[model samples]
Target: MSDIAKEIENAKRIIAEQKKRIKDAQKEAAKAESKLRDRQNYILGGALVKLAETDERAVRTIETLLKLVDRPSDRKAFEVFSRLPALSLPPQPAPDTGHE
Candidate 1:
């Protein structure tokens, strides 16, 4: 085989490898983004639950703030929270008696 032909073949192989790597990287990035989104939703749900338990008025304030923002994500979050039923913390256990 001619030297130039071998060089051209090598270049084509390198290009194919690079394309595969790029595709794999893109898929990994999409997965990471999806996981991050799920984590964010969990954290936000937990926080809203806590706020509702602690102070409903605070939740109203957050709703107001969300209304003031123009972001679509914020509006969507507000809608989700609005649909949830009000939550309250369970009553604290009474102080321990002297008896075990």
Candidate 2:
């Protein structure tokens, strides 16, 4: 009877340890998911900003090209090509990548 009781206590200890591990794992997974979501949001916002910058730059370049062209046909074509969707918001300055 004593040996049986000892075995039951040992089993309970093992179960308790496993339960703790499972809880820890669940918490870790939630933390990881939160971090992943933050990273994804950061990347998405950056990409949208980059695309806006590119569009703005293209429009400016096209305008300059149109001015430089002497022929009417070339200027018209460039004007048509340069037209793009209006930006929803003003473009933000790109962060400098050169600094450490």
Candidate 3:
């Protein structure tokens, strides 16, 4: 083959390799972002659970929200919250005016 033919083949190979590399990088980035999102959800859920354990409003709100969980598995996962006794939430504390 001529030199020009060989150079064209080499350039095409490089382009193909670069495309694969870009695709792999994008997949890796997407996976990392998914993991981060899951971690954030896990942390937020834990905080909510902790708050619900002590606060009447939080418990009631969480129980109310659980009604929206239509999936059997999700409903089953929420069984732990079902055991909290219903309680009247205390009036919310007034916000500080910062005037002092």
Candidate 4:
């Protein structure tokens, strides 16, 4: 083969490799983003659970905020949760006084 033809083939191969690398990088980036979203959801769920246990009003505020999401699924989830029974914290025992 001619030197020019060999050079062109090499350039093509390089371009193909770069394209493959770019695709792989994009997939990795998507996976990373998905994992980040999952982690954020876990953290949000934990926070909401704690807030619900501590204060029903705060949980209601979060439900109201969820309605602001443009996604229908978010609103639907909030509605479903609204129908569920409210979380009640366990009653705390009264502190004993030194008199007893």
For each candidate, the alpha-carbon lDDT, in order, equals 0.69, 0.64, 0.74, 0.70
Off by over 4 Å in 4: 65-84, 87-100
lDDT of 1 by residue, 12-62 (tens): 999999999999999999999999999999898678757756787867765
Model 4, 84: alpha-carbon shift in Å?
6.0
2 or 4, which is superior by TM-score?
4
Candidate 3 structure quality by residue, lDDT tens digits, 1-100? 9999999999999999999999999999999999999999989977877898888777767767765676655655554544453432233445599988
lDDT of 2 at 90: 29
Clashes of 1: 0
Best by lDDT: 3
User: What is the C-alpha local distance difference test score of candidate 3?
Assistant: 0.74
**lDDT for position 29 in model 1:** 100
Give the poorly placed runs of model 3, Cα more than 4 Å off. Answer: 80-100
Alpha-carbon RMSD, candidate 2: 15.4
Give the least accurate 10-residue stretch of model 1, judged by summed lDDT.
82-91
Residue 71 in candidate 3, Cα distance off native in Å: 1.8
For residues 1-66, what per-residue lDDT tens digits would candidate 4 score against the true structure? 999999999999999999999999999999999999999998997787677767878778766665
Ranking by lDDT: 3, 4, 1, 2
